[model samples]
Target: MKENVALIGWIATVMTGVVAPALILALIWKTPDTLLRTGEAGQFVSATASVGGFFSSDITTVQSTTGSIAVYNTFSAPRNQLLVVRETLKNGLQLCAENKPDTCVGLAGSWAGDMKPVPHARHRFAGLVTGIGNSGASLWLLIGILVSVGATGILAQHVDREGRRRS
Candidate 1:
């Protein structure tokens, strides 16, 4: 019985400490930093999460009081929230995604954002945010480490019992 328990412990240690991590690394090795694909229910093709918790770009968010503006949260990460400008330009200003005749205000501006990060925030609204506010890689790594600790504890309990018997 003691031998069997020790063998199980060694097996668990090897599996948790080596094999499992190696498998995870292999699975993620070929994964791309950015992905774009449509959803199953006739959704738009979008760039998937980039490395870390941020997207491949930092989307800017703006708020104005003199007029109404559209709200769009591009990168859904923590630190993804960049410049939040609430300008009150006197001109009947309109910020468009594109430049065309009489479309976007051709005025001097700054703080157009793009480029990804590990994320440190979410959309100001509650419904737009999800997950534990961390990257999947970090979550998985944490899980793996926790499981490994549990396995080690199990092995240690049995080994301690066996040692007491010897003494």
Candidate 2:
């Protein structure tokens, strides 16, 4: 009787967990792209994001480096605004040559809002992940949860209590 009751409880728990996520996914799948129309609301959101991104993060308004240029704001945060205008190359300032236009060197490229400073961050490794993460914070939260779960799993493997001992 006890085993049967426990089995039923386990099944219910599994069903609730699986069904809730499935239903949510189905709803999202059925949702139309036009659900959130682009107009005043979109513009307002973009404006808010630009202002908020600038204040919340260590984003410089304008940055010019040897290989690229960067501007941090909601609209441009995901990618560096690299524009090339006609100019005479008589001389380049040490600051410009060194790419130290204040927070400019750190940005490597578009994936980095400039160019990648990290080791071996080749083009193959899709920038969409980092780009989205850089622009929106929701990705960070999802990554954090994944990392926490993995860490907890590792701890569970190694940090077990002592086995029961009998005299």
Candidate 3:
């Protein structure tokens, strides 16, 4: 009866320590960091776009009282032409121009109250941003799992030996 109990305990300890650790390591090994980063970036872009879309109709006109000379004017053309230009500018700013360090800093400092400096802030779906965030989280989780598994494996071996001795 004592031997049976010891054997059961030993098996349980192995499962808790050895198998669990192995599973964690396997998961970590399967998920690469770059893949996670890509996913996170995608998610962030998606979420930003989704929320941006909701507020698209609520366009706020910025009246520049400071009299900055404009380099380009869409107002000189028809409404459709102006719309196309605006769309193009928005896309360009969101994807390419926004990431430039000088532009980012300048815009962030220049923008008025409650305005976030998103160089690439354009309306789109939330999938990209959510995916990116999830991927990053997954990578962190994998790292945590790896560390936990390593510690638990050591503990399990110790417990297994102790159980064997008792048996």
| Candidate number of the best TM-score | 1
By lDDT, the best candidate is 1
> Runs in model 2 with CA error above 4 Å?
36-167
Candidate ordering by TM-score (highest first): 1, 2, 3
Q: What is the lDDT of residue 48 in candidate 1?
A: 32
Per-model C-alpha lDDT, please?
0.38, 0.30, 0.32
TM-scores, one per candidate = 0.34, 0.27, 0.25
Candidate 1, which ten residues in sequence have the lowest lDDT sum? 35-44
Give the TM-score comparing model 2 with the true structure, all chains together.
0.27
* Model 3 ranges with Cα > 4 A deviation: 1-132
Q: Model 1, 33-133: lDDT tens per residue?
A: 22111111111222232232354333333332222223232322222122222211122122332212122321224323332332432233221132212
Looking at model 1, residue 46 earns an lDDT score of 28
Q: After the best TM-score superposition of candidate 3, give how far the Cα of residue 20 lies from its true spot, in angstroms.
A: 16
- For 15-127, candidate 2 gives per-residue lDDT tens digits of 44444344444443343322111111011111122243433544333333323333233222223323222111111111111222232222212322222233432332122
Better of 1 and 2 by TM-score: 1
lDDT of 1 at 153: 81
What shift in Å separates residue 25 of candidate 3 from its native position after superposition? Answer: 18
